[model samples]
Target: MTWNYAYSQDLWPAMISVASTIFLGFYSWNRRNVPGAKAFAIGCLFAMLWAIGTSLEIAAMDFSTKIYWMKFHALWQIPTVTALSCFFIEYAGLGRFLTRRNLVLLSIPALLVFSLMVTNNYHQLIWTSFELEEYVVAKYGIGTWVSIGYANLLGLVNLFALLRLAIRSSRSRWPVAIMLFGQISGRFMYVIDSLYNHIFSPGESVLVVIGLSCSLYAFALFHFRVLDPILLARTIVIEQMSDGMLVLDMQGHIVDINPAATEIFNRPASSLCGRAIVEMMPSDSGIEVQPGKIELTKFEINLGLGDAARYYSLGLTHLLDKSGEALGYLLLLHNTTEQRRSHELLLDKQRVVATLQERERLARELHDSIGQVLGYISMQAQTAQNWAVAGNTGKTVPILSRLSEVAQEAHADVRESIFSLRAGMESEWSFLHALRKYLDHYHTSFDIDTELLLPEELSEDILNPDVGIQVMRVIQEALTNARKHGGAHKVKVVFVEEDGYVIISISDDGIGFNQADLILEVGKHFGLTFMRERMTQIGGSVIIESQPGSGTTVVLDVPIGT
Candidate 1:
């Protein structure tokens, strides 16, 4: 004989379960790449299977058919707790502990239980007897209690894991808390139904509770952005990056800091968060600004903590909303202590090498100029002595006068070399001060009138030492060229800031050579080439304005970034 099944109102709980299953399954599918999503999907599949089997059992009218459906439903029920445990572990960021070996071990009990229920006819271990009362099927056996006990144990484990995670992370606590409460309530209802007959059929109240809980979960997932916190925390690329990151609110307070940031600040994230950023900044950092309208700022800062000091290049950008309103600031700190130190050390080595090379060049110039003049004077003295010994006084007078003139020329050359060497060795003056001293000396020595036009608001500290050196060298070269080559009698210098650059202009009231002559005979005019190279090295430019019978004007434009 064949049996036909009829629909039952009791299947409402199963319908709800199926709907929840579809929603959760789709949720898991959408978040397939997300951590723990596979485990969540597995749990949803098992839950859906449980709902289908339970629906079949409730719809059956005969005792044997109900028993058959009940046994089939046990297949879904037996693994539900295990799958939930796996999901909970992964969801809590404790997936490292759930190895393949551990999973296989966990599956053993579920498999054994499933097998016992399927072969209940041969062994009677799952259900020794079955009875139908008011269209409800109830089973009694040692296996029934054992399955409940095992499932409860697994549920307890999942609850504990989620509870631990909820306690640890403030961002994801609510969702985990809700899941824990739901599992406890559903298990309590299951135990109550098993102990005494209730208005709701066996497993119906539990399914209803679970289904409601899943709905709540889906709501939390879509509505609250519940997954983002854990996702960011576990993403290996961001977590492992070396650059420090900080997310700040518009209140100038520290909101969130990454691990690298924590290390950079030399404080734990717990203590650093919620504190005002001004308190953490170095005294010289100059980061003072209103909270909401953070300016686009980029600079290097040095933070000193006892014996440990580090340099960091700080960059601040406005975190804007979709409508372009200011949300907060994203601060990126790139640690540059090692790189800066290496660069400084390299500069130091270069300076030493340059000093040695300069000394060699000076030695060669001395030998070629003053030394040659001195040797010529010695030869003239010997010739004058021979002329005097021969009593040729008439020839001696002109020869002695020539010797005196050569001696005077050598003396001037020696004085000039000493002045040049002294100027090269003086390394500790501000750019403006050094240029002033140089111009004063030039005016006093050459009797040239000098005028200086300087911006009073210019801060000396803003100029980089390296840039100052290059600028000063260019000024010196231009002044020397004006006095010697162009015979400049009056000079003017002006300093101004324009378009993110510092411009210094030096003009002379001297006869100037043709610009074409300077370009064509570049080898003879090494000073202009040196000035151009020095300006270029510091991301600056040089402009020369000159023509024959017109005074030359040299303008140096240097970017302020350096």
Candidate 2:
């Protein structure tokens, strides 16, 4: 082919189209990793090629050179339309249709048209005849009409995708509207150029007008951030998060929910949206979801029953607009079932440890007190039997009386030990109430009168449960000593709070022993030792006061908040 080039008025518009398209092509290419950007870049590049070929065809003076450039321009037209169609489909969030197989199928028509246009010399199928007039004119053939129809069909699909997107997404409407206008304007210019060439042709290539219309795409891209990945990233994060998320309106109705939220409620998003949140919650959830009344930041709720039970920590957050006006609420349900199970297991282990410790203490008490007393009684009985067999009644009588007294003391100790073993705090009873109940039971069992004097201001909340148990044990020991050792008829237990300490006094109207003699025998008295040890374990102290003629008093000074 021979080339003869001459500049025409149409060269200016074609050159402008080339520059604009090349700029958009490079811009789109830089954002190729974003959804739909690669296809948009391909479309821009082909549009640039069409502009370059049309410029060359318009400037050529001979029919043959003009025909060659027209064929080149025609070759890029189908690829441009196909690429833009794919971009629109992807932009509308219909990327599932753009599979590799579908892309290959879409390209087949472009390839067939390209081959026919390239082989037009042998078939004369693309253009039947060419004339060199004021402008180079060509008669269209069956192949040319077929390519036009296919391009038009692709354009219609692209328009439909954009229109649907504009209708569904309010935020995306502006950009989609711009793109739709560009596409429709390009198609309209093409139709006007083809049908009214003699009367309305402005001596400019139709490619120039189409390329200018596509510049609206570049404007939308720059102004609206059409290729930004922020929206896509947000959607992915929300859908894939492990924590269930719900977006609710000011009326406490579900506006939207993530996939995790759907799974948590065992309902679809379509079924959940527009329904009241309280209706969706479990009946026993105890969640107050009355819009402005939902002040709870974190709450635990149980769903299901038995082995299928799940625990969740629901967190509420207020959604506000820029003006600080409340828009809605966001509910985040985090699964805490595993954490709850672990806590229960720990409590079980603690209970086991406490039970073991209690058993060890009981064994020690038996060994230190009852066991030793029983052994002494056994030795005395043997001695008395020996004396009686030898006919020595004088020594045997005194020994038998001592044995009777020791046996009675041992019996009282056995009863006290059994009472201590059976004592436990019930969940519903307060410490003071339980203590009074125990005193009533003690009076009935021991046949001794007991009086409890408690301070009116003293509350059960001040003492720890573990410390309360030890205090009760110490009180029991004091009452037992009053009856068995002091021979007391009546006892009074008094409680007083002073200087951040609770002072409990257990006084008995018994024949008291000398304080000096009691000090000397302190190591032999297991009850006193046990009481002191128990009080010390709970950050408290035990004090005993007595005189030869006065009553005995056991004083407990327990520090508050221990």
Candidate 3:
């Protein structure tokens, strides 16, 4: 029995008290710079005093020493409760209540208790009677009960303050509530211990409660960031963000749209918040997403109407709850209209520079080829005239033949120049109409029966300018090949759309060359090669079918709007 008593007195309460003191002291130090730190630290100091005084009282062998430390333990009780109450008030954002007049009023009870505890020798106010039990003195008095009731009242007020703060905060409230519950449970057990007089053990069970409460406080501080406003202020930052934001519920209906989103959509927030996302998206933007699916990749879309068309890059994210269940979706839109405009302007400048360079090249070619050919023709005509004056008839005849040959060569050079210029410039409706007329004239000049077929819906807008130019070149080349190489002379030109493609087929009933002969004589089909290359460059294809006796057909397939 003596060994059990020593172990209970020296080991149990000492171990629990020391552990609680170390942890609470460390917690107080860590948050020394936080708001309400001074009040919280004062509470910690009182708690440490309670723990150490209890341990020293347990270790004291004499009744006098035990009684002396008992008073010391009681000395810290009022201060601890008072300081914790102050901490709770500050934590609840009610610091204004801690005025000089209110604080002095609050301090009266603690000061009276301290004076009574120190002057207890003169009168047995705090301890009316005492007796030694289990090598420790246990005291009883009405004053002790009064102090206990008073401390408990202060604790209840602090707990209520914590609950109020938890309910009012916009951030997560569960952590604070959990801490408050822990304190409540600890205080309930302490009341039971004080009433029953060590139903478990003398002051040992209360120390365990204190340790548990301290753990709860630390949990709330670290996990919930109880003293910081980082999570609480997120709503303010999001409200003022520059990029547009829209939040959608699981049904894909817009639930919230911020001011920036309203500005970007050019609509008031009232109009956008309750509408469906599909109804709000611009026509022809081609945005497709499945409901509830997480889409992290962003896409670009052209929005707005006509001349005010603006571009936006959009991203979607899934919003999740604490349990990781998908709640809804968040859409973010960033305006990229200005950047896209600058890019297109840069492309336009490059095209203009390219056109100027091509014009300079044409001028140099005219000077080198046509100009020299005309000069040669003038010299030959002069020579022929001089020979005629000299009466050299034979020499003049041969010179005349040479002059005729030079003139024909110059005519071919002029025709080639005209064709080259037309290929570069034929992009609009006027060019297409003029080309159809030219085709009619060419067939008449060549004495070939020709038929032209065009679709009723064919328009210049359906074709890109660069692709149209290449298409014209390819058609002109095909016609030249059919008229020059083929003997039979019935031709047909057809323009039609099929399977998202614009097909131009030129067919001729003529003596066609063998496909096998193309390998042996590649140079003989240079026109076909050039036609295939031009179509391929513009994301199109060409197919040629020809045989010895059968007709020849060249089909050019270009993607619509390519």
Root-mean-square deviation of each candidate, in angstroms?
4.8, 7.2, 12.0
Candidate closer to the true structure by lDDT (higher is better), 1 or 3 = 1
lDDT of 1 by residue, 13-93 (tens): 877887788778777867766777777778888878877777887777677777777667668776777887887888777
Ranking by TM-score: 1, 2, 3
Q: Candidate 2, residues 1-562: lDDT per residue as tens digits?
A: 6798988887877777888878888887888888899998898888888888988888887778887888788789889889989999998888899999999999999899889989998998988987766666678789887887888899889888888766544457789988888888887777666656423222255443556566788778888888867865776687689999988887888888887988998987778889988899886666576636555533878788898999999888889999999999999999989999999999799779768867787787788878888899899999999999999999999999998998887887787677665665476645676678778877887788999997788887667676777888899889888887788888999999999899999999988888887678867776787788889888899999987667799999998887
Model 1: ten consecutive residues of lowest lDDT: 416-425
Candidate lDDT (C-alpha), each: 0.76, 0.81, 0.73
Clashes of each: 0, 0, 0
Clashing pairs in 2: none
TM-score: model 2 vs. ground truth: 0.65
lDDT of candidate model 1 versus the reference: 0.76
TM-score of 1: 0.78
